[model samples]
Target: MIAHVLDIFFPPLCELCREVLREGHSLCGDCAANLKRIESPFCQKCGEPFDGQIESHFSCPNCSTIELAFDFARSPLQAAGPARELIHALKYRSRFYLADEFAPFFMELLEQDERLSDLPQNTLVVPVPLHWWRQQIRQGNQANEIAKSFCQSSGLPFLPALQRIRRTETQTRLTRKQRLSNLHNAFRIREKMREKLTGATVILIDDVFTTGSTAHECARLLKKKASVERVIVLTLLRG
Candidate 1:
C-alpha cells in the first residue's frame, strides 16, 4: 500500500529513456532492448570484441604482448550508450539502486561462461576494492555493491580479499604505460582474508575493464600474496 502510494506520487521511469515502467524495474523494455551485448569474435584473454570475422577464439593485440595475472576477463556489455550512462550514474552520480538492475545480467553472463558456471567448492567472488579515502568520499564502493548484488542472486560467496594500499589518480586519461605504472603496488591482500584465499578461484568484480591495468594489478596481488589458484576478472562493461 505504501509502495503503491509512493509510485503514484513518483511514478517509476526508465533510467535511460524516462519511459514509464511498472513497479520493481529500473529500465523499461525499450531501454533494456537497446543494450548491446558483446558477441563472438572477441579476444579470449581480455574479451575485447573484434570488428572482423574470426571463427576461432583468439587474443587481442593488447593481450598478446602483455602478461596479465588473471586467466581471462569478460564483460556482458560494450561500454557505450545506455550501458556507459548507467555505469556513470551508479559510480559517479550515486545512483546505487542500479546495482540491483545489473545483477541479473551478471548472473546470466556467468552462467553462459563454462569456465565460471561450474564453480569449485573453493571458489569466491571478490570485488576490486576502493581505497579508504575513496570509500569515504563516495560513501560506498560501486564495485562492491555490484559484486554483493551478484553474489546474493547467484548464491556465490562474496569475499573482499583485496585492498587498495595506494590511492592513485584516475586512469581515464592515462596511457597504457601510465596506467600500469600508476597501479604498481596499488593493491594488497587483506590480512584477515589471507587464509580464505589459499588455492581459491577468485572472480574479481569491477564496473569497467579499460586497458585492464587495474584488474591485472589486483589479480597479481591475490596470486602472489595469497596463493590464489586462479583469477577471473568480471566487469559490467568493457571500455
Candidate 2:
C-alpha cells in the first residue's frame, strides 16, 4: 500500500526528538523517561507537589485557604520538559496523535493511586469542553481526545456531558480571582445528561491543570446542577 511504501522510504520519527523510531510513536523511551513526574508530599485536596519530607494527606498552604470544589486533583507529570512539549504539540500544532501517548500517564495514575483506584462503580468521565467557536478554530478539542483515549484504556464511560456556554479570556495571565470570574457560569451540564449524574462520582478530564479555576468551575456546575456525589480531576500535567 502507499502508506507502507512511505514508511519504508521514510520511517516514522519520534515526535519529540525526531529520532528514527523502531516503531511509530509520539515519544521515544528516552524522552518519556526524561519527563519530570510529580511525587508525593503533595496536598491531599489539590495534588500540588511539595518539597522535603512531610506528613501525607495534609492540605497544602494554598488549598487550606482556597478550598477547591473538587474532592481532589492529580497529574502524573509537571508541566515541563517533554510533557509540556507534547501538550503544546497536541493543543496548538494539531498533532491529534499525541493523545494516545499522553493518556497512559493518566491511566497509570489512576491505577497507582489508592483513592482513585476505588472510585464508586457509577463514576463518569467528563472532558472539559471547548466553546463552539474555539473548537471550530482549533478543528478539534484536544481535551476530549485525551479524555476519550483515557476512558477507552481505563474501561470508563466517556461523556461529553459538559458544554461551555461562553467564551472566556485566556487564563494564562489572569489572577486567580480574575480567572474564577471569567469562568463563572461558563460551563453547564447538558440537559439530557443531567439525569445520569445524580449521586455519581465525576472524573473531570483536561489536558493541563494550571490555577485549576477551570476544573473548579466545572465541578461547581456539576455539583449544583447535577448533584454529582464527588468530583476528581485528572489532568496530564500540573502547571
Candidate 3:
C-alpha cells in the first residue's frame, strides 16, 4: 500500500531514457534492448568476445600468453551501449539504485555457468575494493553495492575480504603491463576475514573487467596470502 502511494506521487522513470514507467524496471524496453549480451565464441578464460566463428570454447591469444591468478573470468554483457551508460551512472554519477538492476544480470550469469551454478559450501562473493580516498570521494563502492544486491537475491555469503592498501593512478590510458605495475601491492586481505579465506572459492565481483589487471591483482592476493583455493572473476561487463 505504501509503495503504491509512493508510485502515484513519483512515477518511476527509466534510468536511461527518463521515460515514465508503469512498472518498477530501471530501463525502458527500447533501452534495455540496446544493451548487448556477450554471446559464445568468447575467450573461456577472460570472457573476451570473439568476432569469428568457433564451436568449442577457447582462450584468446592474450590469455594464452599470460598467467592469470583467477581460475576463469566471465561476464554476461558487453561493456557498450546502454550497459556502459548504466555502469557510468552507478560508479561516476552516484546512481546507487542501479545496483539492484544489475543484480538480476549477475544471477543470470551464475545460472548459465555450470562451474559457478554449483558453488561449494566454502564459496563467498567478494567485491573488489576501492582505495580509501576513492571510496570517500565516491561515498560508496559500486562493486560492493552490486555484490550486496546479488548476495541478497542468490542467498550467497558476502565477504568484503579485500582492502586497497595503495591508491594507484587511473589505468584508462595505461598499457597492460603498466596497469599491472600500478596495482602491485595495492590490495591486501582484511585481517578479520583471513580465516574465512582458507581453502575458499572466492567469486570476485566487479563492475568491469578492462585489461583485467585489477582482478588479477586481487586474485593473486587472495590465493597467495590467504591460501584461497580458487578465484572466479565475475563482472557486469567484459571491457
Write the residue-wise lDDT of candidate 2 on 1-239 in tens digits.
99889988988888878998886376787887788888898878878898999964798777878867898999999998778988988998878889988777887798788998788889989999999999998889999999998988888999889999999988888899899999998988899999999999999999999888999999998998899999999999998
**Model 3, which residues run further than 4 Å from truth?**
1-3
Q: What CA RMSD would candidate 1 show?
A: 1.3
Query: Against the hidden reference, what TM-scores do the models get?
Result: 0.96, 0.96, 0.95
List clash counts for every candidate, in order: 0, 0, 0
Off by over 4 Å in 1: none
Residue pairs in collision within model 2: none
lDDT per residue (tens digit) for residues 15-93 in model 3: 9889999765687777766778887888999999999789998999999999999999999899987899899999998
What overall lDDT goes with each candidate model? 0.90, 0.88, 0.91
Q: Which pairs clash in model 1?
A: none
Better of 2 and 3 by lDDT: 3
Residues 20-112, model 1: lDDT tens digits:
897557898677767999877789999999887999778888889989999999999999988999999999888888999898778778778
Q: Which sections of candidate 2 miss by over 4 Å?
A: none
Candidate with maximal lDDT: 3
Give the root-mean-square deviation of each candidate in angstroms: 1.3, 1.2, 1.4
